[model samples]
Target: MATEREIFSNSGPLDLTAVDWTNSQHRRTVAASLVQGTYSMEHDRQQKLQGHLALGPPWWEFFNFQPVQVLVDEHDLSIFGAIFKFKFPPSYGNYLPQNPPQYVVAFRGTITKTDTKKQDLKLDFQFIRNRLHQSTRVHLAMQAVQNMVSIAGAANIWLAGHSLGSAIALVAGKNMVKMGCFIETYLFNPPFTSVPIERVKNEKLKHGIRFTTSVIKAGVAIALNSQHQRSQKDHSFNILSGWIPYLFVNPSDPICSEYIGYFEHREKMMEVGIGNIARLATQNSLGNLILGATGKDSEPPHLIPSAYLTINVSPTQDLKQAHGIQQWWKQNINCQFKLHQYR
Candidate 1:
């Protein structure tokens, strides 16, 4: 109650351009727990963000971000995302961090197949870009990013996503960098593309990908999501230097199961649970969907041969182990190994 009252007394909800979750050590610790595929701890972290917690590993004094504004549609909560700004806590300048933190934009992924409109939007984002956000609350978040650049001169930014969100991050990264901002994007289990990876590089963006441990195990065939079965790469596999794409794969993911070695060190080994397992199953269901949801002829463009994976084991158990956000935090980030360096 006190927390709510204090928030109400504030000038406004947290501003998106000022708070940086990336700089919070405590936040990173909680994210690491999620990477280990623990959703309970992740929920606690979310509650902390909501200011419902009385105490935790650290106080708000060291907090790196605030609620700011979450972009969501009034009618449907599923079709929404959020934008968070970086806030320098007290003593922040005393202990100068290595790099200046930037704003983070997180696009939520699809969890259920019940919402047909939301499902169509994901398809459009993947297959066509006639209109994204479609006057939805995301426009407000995009406007905030514009203010961060044109108004605040904060050029550094980080883009992140999961499942369908990863696909969205790619587009956002492309647009932001073209705006002349240095953008670093992290994609957790982005869908595969038979279209030469080089083709996307022509668009000029540096990004990273993460997957499950089972996907990396021997004998699992890999495949990308296919929105339009007709869409394919005009050229063969041609590696390009301009776009640096790092892939992180763990165990048992239906979408990103195996790494065919796009590049050395591009793929990293990682380590997940029921909430996570449930999510993995949900992601698997994506395969049979989109086609039905959007009334398209085919499922979202899954690459030939893959985005294809040869699953020898029970899909439930296999998909249970997913390469989503949690493993990315545990292995690629907040880990003693610091495997990201290799990428």
Candidate 2:
């Protein structure tokens, strides 16, 4: 695992204006740096911004982006995210792609520090309960995203977050998609609220368990069909089928590894002539179904309809390294990628 110092340069000013955004490595490194900036702002806000007088400029500046606004948690007054605007215009040159993002909204994961731990963990708990969208932080994030989308078109904006922050971004991005807006998104080690069944070593046992679970979810969905029509959120998934967000996961990271099996198992179900059942099961979690039946609005945070899944196959020493946002910026790591589109 690379240290924070190794992953981020602190020696002197670095320039990335000429870097090719078309390259995946460049994009990943830049996105990770922006996310790291949120952490810096929360802990060491004053020093890092002091240009050459200090050790060096903040990491986001190294990539020719400036923080336009800092997203603060209303309850704790702690910074959790930032909106970055590229220094150059989209029409700058051919170096960047035609539809390069003019603005990026990057969010940091849980910060277990003395100052921010309580609020961060509270949001994490809300995530586990499928209630993150009801939190003030998430609502603020969604509002920030919406304002940015209105100013810069959705095609010119991007969303990136890690761990719990990724869950916030997912909810905001999903809402934007429901409104017929599709923004490019990047998620790193986003927590999936489910049994860590992806860690089961025995393939036969794993497949059997997942198959049974899918059948149960499908049966519940069927039972609820007559009593309750699909929620507006559920119906929006049909529109979300094509807006593919990029998910970065490590097999060793229990917090996010289930994404690998989530998509792969859906393919297996399709091959077995149970595609329709799995489709309904994948979108409607049992918790959401029960809550919806009780006239409560609930949506599963990790029930993404489609994504471009990137799995880090590299070895890690511990869970910290496995789930750390630093892993995404490392160069030459072994990674496997697949685009999972749900019909």
Candidate 3:
């Protein structure tokens, strides 16, 4: 476990007096910090469950957020998420944006501690199996976000999570998008759950394999479409194409690095005069295609049509460091962001 200082040294205390809600950097740091606070909430719960005093102020204390609702897993009874209300001091007096979201629903990733490890690991497994949306945790998360959107309205609600929790956030946000409710979302180190071909040593071989795979997938989708009519979900995905969520990923994290390639490959396809093939390929995956053929409605959680993809280019020592949520708020990290809109 990292010390509090080690995790937050770069983030420091957020300056509420000067924070501009519209600024990208301010928004990313704040969202990442809130997710860290959700992580702290579970840690605080465990310490109290074992009858020990929790040390240090809440990680989100500097960000002026209060957890209004804590999401506990129904079956495992472990803390996994929270809904935080922003406290805008009156003294600040109209400095921030007039319509900034008042609440942020944030979720924390896998906690390996004895108390929460079982449930956290279970959710991680569900994520890898692409059954995370069917899990009780995701159901709870979706309901929580839905309730918040009802109360705060879509424009006044933000969603954020890390790792396994980010997958939860992604699915929930996708559901909301399907319902025509688009909430501002931030996902840090969200797992891609595909082959880690992004780590291949040969660039030419990597591009060759990906391009070939794209063409095959595209062909299969077209053949399947002719045999069976497209489902309503397939049509609804067009709406999803317009809702761009912010994705923060590290290039070295195998769990999320594929996203860097996912978007880049589409652009590469365009350059090679095969953009049409990638257009369909990028939308539907092999898993979803098989599911569709069998008449099961399956949407690939990681296959969003658009995103503000922020790639952390900083070198990391290992996958653990690269995948950790703390890296996002760290100072001096090199990050490059591009908007990938798949048409």
Candidate 4:
């Protein structure tokens, strides 16, 4: 962990792009509150089989993120696998009017269940195909965010989620983009949208670039960013409209590494010409024969968009705490933000 006065870096020589340190720290701090809400959901469940909480008073004091509110009210959100949702101040942009505070929404990841966590991951993949709303859990989250935005008339409604929650955030953010809503996302150890490549039944048939119709559009936007100042507004899908994403991941964590790193891998490959060739060659049915090939783990047509700062960490300092939010904070508390050459 790097101190406030120090720069955050990796053990290796990866030249990292930095983010706005104060704002980055604030997002992590907000993420911490949402993390606590997850634990409270679990304990409250054990006691009375409850599903949501208000997270007020003393707890919000610790983070000093005041005037907080939890949307969805007394209604239980567990059936949708959206265990918890919280409202806090946005890290970017200002409100149209000062009456309502500019706000952001954070979602709690899946609770232990075949239905909640596992199920949402399957639905998350459809995000690129333009099919995210098909999932009930995701649809519910989207509605909640939309409703919150409507009530607050939030100039910008930022979304953050962990694990499956992060995936939901990505999908919902995409939908928000389509609506031309102002938004930003922070994903904590977000999972990739596809299963392992080895698991594909007919590997030979599916080989080549995993570029989905939409994923290709996103890839091109990223390749351009590697060389120019194209903002999200310039991207075809509106992915680069204002700012790129703020991503936090453990490099070796299987959920994100073996699975989710696909989006990251695709960006790197395309920046080097794999995407261009994949786009050009595929025009020939036979040229498509060469197959651009998906990441060792990513899906083609990577639609989640780009990252302003992809903060890679090794918080598995204690193996037991590898994916734990506490570990994530313990590692990120001493944080820094900078501009590195785009990866």
Report RMSD (Å) for each prediction in the order shown.
13.6, 3.3, 2.7, 11.1
The C-alpha local distance difference test score for the whole of candidate 1 amounts to 0.37
Model 2 Cα displacement at 75 (Å)?
A: 1.4
Candidates in order have lDDT scores of 0.37, 0.82, 0.81, 0.46
C-alpha positional error of residue 81 in candidate 3 after TM-score superposition, expressed in Å: 0.5
Backbone clashes counted, model 2? 0
Best by TM-score: 3
Worst 10 residues of 2 by lDDT: 48-57
Please provide TM-scores, in order, for all candidate models, with all chains considered together.
0.47, 0.90, 0.91, 0.57
lDDT of 3: 0.81
Alpha-carbon shift of residue 196 in model 1 (angstroms) = 14
Writing each residue's lDDT as its tens digit, candidate 2 over 36-109 gives 77777776543334444332136676777888899998788888999999886465576545445799999989
- Sort by TM-score, best first: 3, 2, 4, 1
Query: How well does candidate 1 score on lDDT at residue 185?
Result: 48
188: Cα error in model 3, Å: 0.4
Displacement of the residue 87 alpha carbon in candidate 2, Å: 0.7
CA shift of 30, model 2, Å: 1.2
Residue runs of model 3 more than 4 Å from their true location after superposition: 5-17, 49-57, 94-99, 231-234, 293-297
**In model 4, how many backbone clashes occur?**
23
lDDT of 2 at 267: 91
In terms of lDDT, model 4 sits at: 0.46
